[model samples]
Target: MQIEIVEVLDQERAMVAFNSPVGSAAGVWKGGQGLETGTHHVEFEIPDEVHSWSLVQPTHGAITGGGARGGDFVTVHGQVEGVGEDSVVTLRIGPDVIFVEMEDSVERLNQGDYVTFNSPTVEIYPYQT
Candidate 1:
């Protein structure tokens, strides 16, 4: 699978639309930190495939100001079903993903440069084996 960049809103945020060769559908991502504030919209070309994707919420995780904690890591564990499709993915900040002490409209998330969300303080780390 491959993720293509459709648009970049700014240095902190971007608007990306994805395509999957396995299927003839597309997904769009909008809103995130350094961008605008509000309920960002993600329109899927295949509404029928909505259920095809799954969401993984963060388990027990923590982020600290100092490296003394070793490294701040958030694990979004879940499976992607539907066999084949270029999943146009988007990251949303629900109560489950946000800290109780966080009062920012945009919170930092753990997504890559291709992913987008409306959070001000997210640091994306790759999975290491």
Candidate 2:
């Protein structure tokens, strides 16, 4: 779906918030994937992990297979630790842990629920404001 960049929270980490279609409330992904705040035409495979985030990969599970060095690391295969305010989803993958800021439009996730995203790429197009 087409989306607009709402806020650039962590440009260095590519953690920018995007405005959902509805408005006001925004969503964030693990990486920027070369996206900047403005108008962006994006095609994302919605994840069932409440957050419904997409990763910028060419093939599913190829980069995270060991060390391919892709910035899109949202494929956190583990149980959810908790859900905090602002829709931050915390999850655990073995000894490692991850946090995902979810889109308000997504469904809510429960604690201990299994979460994983196999989507390789979230196609993006940057538009000038």
Per-candidate RMSD vs. true structure?
17.8, 14.0
- Candidate 1, 3-90: lDDT as tens digits: 2333332443332222222211112233334333222223222122222222234432222121111222211222211121243334
User: Residue by residue across 1-129, what tens digits does model 2's lDDT show?
Assistant: 345676665555454555433222223444346656776654333234343543222321211311122344423344667888877777554443455556653245677666555433322234334
Candidate 2 deviant stretches above 4 angstroms: 1-74, 104-107, 118-129
CA error at residue 77 for candidate 2, angstroms:
1.4
Winning model by lDDT: 2
Q: Extract clashing residue pairs from model 2.
A: 57-120
